[model samples]
Target: MDSRVVNKGQLPELLDKLARDHTLIAPVREEENVTLFKKVSGASEVQLDYITSDVSPKGCIFPQTEKTISYTYTGDTLEMKEQDEPPKTVLFGVRPCDINSILALDPVFEGKFLDTYYLEKRKNTVIIGLSCSTILSTCFCTAFNSGPCDGKGADLMFTELGDKYYVEVNTEKGSSLVEAYSQYFSKGDTDKLAKAKEEQAKKLEGQFRRKVDLEGVKQVLDENFELPYWDKVFKKCLGCGICTYVCPTCHCFDIFDYVTGEFTGDRFRCWDSCMFPDFTLMAGGHNPRPSRKERVRNRFMHKLKYHLDRYNLDGCVGCGRCISKCPVNIDITQIIKDLKEVGQNA
Candidate 1:
C-alpha cells in the first residue's frame, strides 16, 4: 500500500536483480507477432513492448502437465511421493485481465477441496502487473469492471508514464521486493502520478473496440438449459478446442498415470477442454455432451453461468485470447451481446 517510481532506464538492472534472486517468469517475443511467458535467463530476455502474450501465464501456477503423485508397488504394499515445494518465484509483466483471471482461479483450487500443487505455487509467487498502454480490437476487460490499469490482485503494479514507471506496492511481498531494491526506486509525487495513471486508464478504456454487456444474460442462461441460438452458434465450431485451451480462466483438467516400469508409475494431470467431443464420454460408451451443439452450449454456459453459480466470479476475464486465436473467428463478446438480446426477448 505504498508508491514509488523507478526510471525506465534502470529497468534492466531491476530485472537482472530479480532474475538473480528469484525464478523470473516474463514475456519473451519468440518470433514475429508471437509472445509467451517464459523462464527468464536474464534481463535481456524480457519483452516489455507487447500488448498481450499469446497465452496466459497460468502455467506458472497450474502447469499444463504436472505430476501429482508417483507410486511404487511392492507385493501388497504401495508407497507414493508428492510433488516438492515450488521455488520463490516472480511472475512479472502480467496484465490486469490476466491478473483477474488468476483471482477467479484462486477460489477454484483453494476452497473446500484444496489443491496443494496449485496453492503452493500461488503462495510462493509474487505477481508484478503491468498497465496496458494500448488496447486491442477484441479487448473487453472493462465489461467485467476491470480496466487496463486495474491492479486489484497484483502484489505490485507498474504504470509507464513517459520517463519512469509508477510503481504501486500492493502487498507485503511487493514491499519486500521494493525494500530490497530501494536504490532503484524513489518516493516521487505518487499522488500526482496516480492521477496520471487514472487518466491513462480512462484514455485506453475508450479505445477498446468491443463493448460487452452482461446485464440479463446470466438470468437467461440460468432459466434455459437449451437454446435455439446455440444451434446457429455451434454450426461454425470445428470442435478443435482452441478456445478452451487458450483461455486464461478455463480450468478443466484430466488426470492419468504413466507407467515407467512394471512396479512403478507417475500420476499426472494435464489441461483438458469441454469443446473436445470425448471430454464427457463415459467408459460405458455414451457421452453426455455427445455432439458439437451440446459441447459448444456447455462451453459458453460454463463461462457465462455455471462458474458464476459455483464461484460467484466471472469465468471469462475478457482477455480476448479466444477471440484472437480462434481459427473460425468465434467471438465470445458477440455471444454475450446475442445472449443479452435473447434475454431481452424472453
Candidate 2:
C-alpha cells in the first residue's frame, strides 16, 4: 500500500540505495540497436524508453545454461559442490509480456515438484514492470489479458506521467521498497495518476494494431490439428530454432554434459526448441514428429492446445517475437486467426 510519486531526477539514487541490499539487475543499453538486462550499479543505465529488447527476460528467471552442481574427484571418492547463487535481484523495466511469462511459469515449475533453483530465485527477485509507452508490432500482451502498465507480476509498477513518474506498490516487497526509499517520492494528487494511467493504457493498447480473440484460439487450433494447413503455412519452414530461443515464454530446455581432455564437466541445461529435427528423434533414429510439417504443427499445438490443457493458461502471451524474428515470418497470431476462420467454415 505504500506508494507515492518518485521525482524523476532521484531515480538513480533510489537504485543506488536498493543496490546496497541486493544485486541490482536492470535493462542496460548494450549497443545502439541492442538492449539487455544486466547487473547494474546505478539506475542511470536503465534504458526504460527502448521499444523492445533484443532478448527476453526469461534468462533472468530460467537461465540459458546452469550447472546444477560441480564434482571433484579424489583417488577413491567424489565430492559435490552445489551452486546456490540464488541471490536477490531487482528486475527493473521488465515488459508486461515478459513478467507475465514468469508468473505463468510459476505453476509449471512449482506444480509437480518444486524446482529449487528456479523457486529460490523466483521468491527472491522483485519485479519492477515498466509501462510500454510504445508497443512494437511484435508486442501483443493485450491479447493475453495483460496491458502495458499492468501491475500483475510487479512488486512495484512505474508509469511515466510527463515530468513525473506514478508509482503503485502492489505487494509487501513493493511496500518495503517504497518505505525504504521515501525521500525520492512525493505524495501526489489523484488527478495526475488517474490521467497518466488512462492515457498510457489507451495509447499502448492502440499500438497493438493486430488483435485476436484469446478465448477462441484454444478450441480452433486444437480441433484443426490434422488439417492441411501446416504444410501451406510452414511451406518454407527451414526448421531453424531462432524463434523459440528469442521467445519470452518458450521454456523447453535440454540437459547435456561436456567432456574434454582438460576437465570433467557437470550436467548442464541449455535452451532447446521443438523446431529442431533431432528434438523428436529417438535412440534408434525412430522419430515421432518426423516431418517439417509435424515440427511446425507441434510448435503451435503445444503453445495453444497442450499448454492450455496442462496449465489452464495460454502458453503464448502473444508477444509476437517469433513472428518478427522468424526467418520465414511465420506469425503465430496469424496462424491462430486462420485456424479460427477454418473453424467458422467447418
Candidate 3:
C-alpha cells in the first residue's frame, strides 16, 4: 500500500471532488443525537469525531426495506420488474470494526447463494476506513484479531495526525484515486508521517481499557453450553432487542411478505435480534431456546463461538454500541471477563 499526507483543512474540498466522480457516503449527524452514513454532497457534513452511532453503517448497503422486485397480478398474467442498474458509491470514514464486519459478512452473502442485491452494491462501492481513536468500555476489536489500524476490509485507510490525515492506498482503485486527486495532497514526508502514524498506532494498539482473551474463546464457549452463569448474568434483561439492532456485527434478520388488501408487496427483511424470545421461536408452538438465559447465552456464543465455526472469524468487532445502548446496562465485556473458562488477563 502506498501512503501519503493530505494538507490540513482541505478534507471538505477533497470530498467534494470525490463526490463529483463518485457517490460519496460518510457519517453525517442528521438530527440531534443521531448519526447516519448518508450521501455526502460535501465533506462539511461528515462527523469524524463520532465514535458510535444509533444506526449501523451496514444499512447503507443492506437497506432496512428494499424492493427486490415489483409484481402486479392480472387475472391472466402477472408483470414483474427487476432492477436495471447497480448501485455505485463510496463508503468513507468507516471504522475498523464496521469495515471488518463487512468483510466477515462477505462469505455469508456471497458464499452459497449470491445475494445479488448485496453483491451489486458491494462491487460498485469502495470502502475508506479510518483508524479509531475513541473507544468505549465495550470495545474489544483486539479479540477478533482487529484493531483501529487493521485494514482488512478497507480499500483505502485514513489516519488522523495533528490537523492533516495520512492516507494509505490499499487497492488499485484507491491508488488511482490518490493519483487522480493529487492536487489536494502534498508530497509525502517520511519522518513526520512515521511519527504521526506511530502516535495513532499507539492509541489503537494500547489505549483500550478492555479486550477479550480470544485464543481459546471459541473452544471455551463451545464447551460451556451448560454454564450456570447465563441465568445470573441476564437476570435483568427485558428482551427488547435493541442491542442487536444497533450492533454492526449482529446480522440476524427475517424476511417476509407484506400484504395489503388484494395483493402483496415485495418480500422484505429487517434487522432481528437474538435477544428477543420470539426470534428463534419454531413452528408448531415450540421454541427450543425459550428462556432469557438461552437468549443471552446465544448472543455471546454466536459472537465468540458460532461465527468462528461458520465463518472462520469471530463475529464481534467490539464497537461498544451494544454496551452503551443496552437499557439494562448489561455489558458483554463484563460477561466475557466473568466467563469461568476464558483465561483471565495476565
Best by lDDT: 1
Misplaced by over 4 Å in model 1 are none
- Extract clashing residue pairs from model 2: none
* Backbone collision tally, model 2: 0
> Can you tell me which runs of candidate 2 are displaced by over 4 Å?
73-77, 260-264
Query: Quick one: ranking by TM-score, best first?
Result: 1, 2, 3
Estimate, for each residue in 157-269, the C-alpha lDDT of model 1 and write its tens digit: 99999998999999999999899999988998889899999999999998988888899999999998888999999999999988988899999999999999999999999
Candidate 1, pairs of clashing residues: none
Q: Candidates' lDDT values, in order?
A: 0.93, 0.80, 0.78
Task: Give the alpha carbon lDDT tens digit for every residue of 1-346 in model 2.
Answer: 5557877777778888777778888888886677787888776677778766778888888888887776666657766777776888888888778888887788877888888778888888989888778877767778788888787878988887877778878898888777777787778774668676887798778878787775666777766768877779778888899888888878888888665323445768888989998898899989998888898888888888887798887788867778888887888878878887778777
Clashing residue pairs in all predictions, respectively, total 0, 0, 0
Pick by lDDT: 1 or 2, better one: 1
Model 3 C-alpha RMSD vs. true structure (Å) is: 2.6
Ranking by lDDT: 1, 2, 3
What TM-score, over all chains together, does every model reach?
A: 0.98, 0.93, 0.91
Task: Report the alpha-carbon TM-score of model 1 versus the true structure.
Answer: 0.98
TM-score of 3: 0.91
lDDT of 3 by residue, 1-346 (tens): 5777887688888888888788889988976769878888878888888776667788777776676776667777766776656656888999888998887777778877898888888888889888877776677787777887777778888888878788877898777777788887666684688677877777667778885665555566766688767778779888888887888777777787665437535656777788887888988879988898899888888877888899887688788888888899988777776773544431
